[model samples]
Target: MVRGLTVLCWAVATPGLLWAAVRLLGVERGPLVQLLAFTPYVAGWSLLPVALSLALRRWWPAGVAAVAAVALIAVVAPRAFGGGSPAGGGGPTLRVLTANLLAGAGDAPTLVRLVRERQVDVLAVQEFTPEAAARLDASGLAELMPHRRLNPVAGTEGSGLYSRFPLTATGVRENPGGFTQAYGTLTAPGAAPATVESVHPAAPYSLGQLRAWERDLDAQPRATPGGPIRILAGDFNATLDHAPLRRLIASGYRDAADATGAGLAGTWGPYLPDQRHSSDRVPAIRRMAARITGDRIPPVTIDHVLVDRRVGVRDVSVLRLPGSDHRPVYAELALPRAELGG
Candidate 1:
């Protein structure tokens, strides 16, 4: 009877454990609330499974182990194959990259290196400084990409937009707190007009600040003079599972990265390298290292490139760039010509 009961408890908790793991992967959607939603799942799988195994020390414990393994496997599968290339047919695809440069953090060289390697078509940078901007310009990135919009905030942590196509200044608006959010009209070679907003909003860590940021985003007008093919990129400082993120989605924006299934790609919290650290700190730093290596919160993803639902994403990636705590997020979106009403 004791052994049977243990097996039952194990079976009951297995699904929850699986859910917790999956929740952990998807937790960044809501940094404060939904992020904590999987706490029960972690407790059940991490502690309860071992406790049940010990209590029910018997032949059936083997069955419990099997169930646990199956549960874990099920949770990780979505992140693995979720963002593959579309099966049969698709339209012209454009690669978009978004990065929070951490005020340049001595990472200009690496950023330049990544740009060349990735062949990024459209680049959105947050926390940009004039010096860093000059460094990128010196690297000849501005010449290579050509089309650009640089916010004149003149700080280490400002925002800017760059593209491989021609650009015309559409509008520029500063939030009430003075952060510059620039919107530009990009004329890609053959695609429809894309209204890209390079925004660097204040981190809405508190309830009051979050509400303000939410209000500010709501005020930004949608794409004009063409169909509504919009791209909101930069360091949003809010997670998707959060209320603000929910609002954006419900209001018709889709996370190009997450929607294309790049849920496991975490892009924040000190993944960069420095010469000062000893090898011991490196070895002992499992949790931080895991967040970087594991690519999930515990590393947060305050940086994003979200598109309206009308667009289709072909590929999404997080570039492991040096200098910033956050990685550069990349998305390949296929905006069908037919979808535009010109």
Candidate 2:
């Protein structure tokens, strides 16, 4: 029993250690390395091995696991607890909400409720299909958000932006792989007009997709400090762990969730339970598996709201939407009076 347990301890600890090393070494190059970039974001799972090692009284293995956990925490903790931009002098607050409709599977009623309840000033939707656009129009969203820009595509690459404030469609960026991002300027009362973009980069599921994803991210206009404030929000399909996103953030923009210490929150997964597994036995086991593995397939923070550092992020929150695989991310931002020369 002791020897078997020792083997098990090594089995778990080795992978954790290897992951930690890879993460710290920044080994991103090939397809596998690119996939490994996402590992640190889910590093919370490392604690499972740590807990097991401690339970088995395996100090050395426990130490190794602990190191792995510590490494992950070191990478992620800053975003969760780091201080954000200081409060700007009194100015108009802009409430923005971003959601990925999962190819228009988002619930119309829920979306309307969120817009009304949150008093959202700016709304951005990804995967905005024509059907979803029609539903949103019928749901009285237009009444609340009078100004709008809708780029309804045939498939999941569609995107849209709606605003209570006046919105002017600026341009649309189309990337390889059919991914589309919509851009607009929102003119809010008593505040300088800010550029807002609804973005949806392609998923990095393959080398081709990964390169396209990087290109899309790179194509996103960088925010200039002390310049016009820009809000980029939607399903980036890449996390802070991705070099492209990290570089983007380092270039004078800040993720709302990270700015507000909500960076650890997951916005994807726990999708409407699979009907095939709806039976009690299968569903329960699936749920158990999800719990055990952190639902790698279902749970991650791929959706985000990124704003210029000059924009004060007051708060950030996530809400589950019916029929969608992703949660809506809302951020309350305040534009500084000085930025607009108010």
Candidate 3:
């Protein structure tokens, strides 16, 4: 009986050890991509296996579980505490916000109210529809953010950018992932010019689209340390745990949420009991992922605002609105000197 119980402890620790291996190696593929988003939760539970093995007086299982627990904690613990790079060159603070409106269905007044209350200087929007654009305009979005470059269509492919500052060299480009990305050069007074892109990468909904999702992430331009300051903001459909996003960040961008220790806040699936998940309209994979994560929060932080490393991150927060699964991500950034972007 003792031997059988020890075997059970080994079984419990094995999956977590595999998870740690996949995460550490960045080898998670297909549906595993969705599951890897739950790394933080798994890291917390890893302690249980260690305790159980030790209590059962099984040294081998205990050692393995302790190794897995340490590895998981090393990967996940840093995000919960703040100590991001202080790279700002002492320029003006730029308040930026990004949100995905869920195909014209998200509440427009609430978005406008967030902008008004938050004093957002730049706003990046994904899943923007023409009707939603008109609704936002009707709700007095133009009064707050007069300058704009929008490509609002009827479906999830549309994207847009609105700013209090002027936008130049503005255009909409269809990314390989089948989403329209709105981008432009933003000129803020007393600070350098920043090129901002509204990002909406293809979600790896199925095994077939996985390549497309990878292409989308790969196509996202890396931050140019020697060139213009850049900010990529919106529903990336990928999280910090993903390898491609990690590569993107390594190329010179800083995740606002991760910088401020809000990285663990679930951004995608609130995963409630009610049919309220009905409103979010996520695909079967996400719903399954919700179940895998115990159908509660559903390991997710897909929406992000990644800024150039030259900028200093002051604060990051998440805000909610009705009818959208993704909440708005707001970041307070201090841009570098005016010449850094030139």
lDDT of each: 0.62, 0.78, 0.85
Q: Model 1 off-target regions past 4 Å?
A: 1-89, 206-208, 217-226, 272-297, 338-342
Query: Residue 10 in model 2: shift from native, Å?
Result: 4.6
Candidate 3 weakest lDDT stretch, 10 residues: 271-280
User: Which residue runs of candidate 2 sit more than 4 Å off their true CA positions?
Assistant: 1-10, 29-42, 47-66, 87-90, 274-298, 338-342
Clashes of each: 6, 1, 0
- Model 2, residue 167: displacement in angstroms? 1.9
**Local error of candidate 2 at 291, Å?**
18
**Cα-based TM-score, every candidate:** 0.69, 0.83, 0.92
Tens-digit lDDT string for candidate 3 (121-238): 9999998998889999999999999999999987789999999999999999898878999998887888999999999989887789889988999899799998888999999988
Ten contiguous residues minimizing lDDT sum, candidate 2: 274-283
- Residue 218 lDDT in model 2? 82
Q: Write the per-residue lDDT of candidate 1 for residues 1-342, one digit (tens) a residue.
A: 865676576675565455555444543232344343233234335545555666666435545555554555454445435644432116556678787765554366677677777787788887677767888889878766877888744444466788887778666667764577767877666566678887776666455565566666565554332355678887776655344555665566666666667755667654644412322222234335544655333556567877765567777788776546677888878764544523
**How high a TM-score does candidate 2 get?**
0.83
Best by lDDT: 3
lDDT of 2 by residue, 1-342 (tens): 998897898789878788777667655555753556457444878898898989999988999989988997788787778576655625788999999876776777789999999999999998888888989989989799988888887558898888898777577778775778888987777777789999887778667676777777887879877667788999988777777787788888889998889887888756645323322222244345446655446466889999877688889998978766678999998876644532
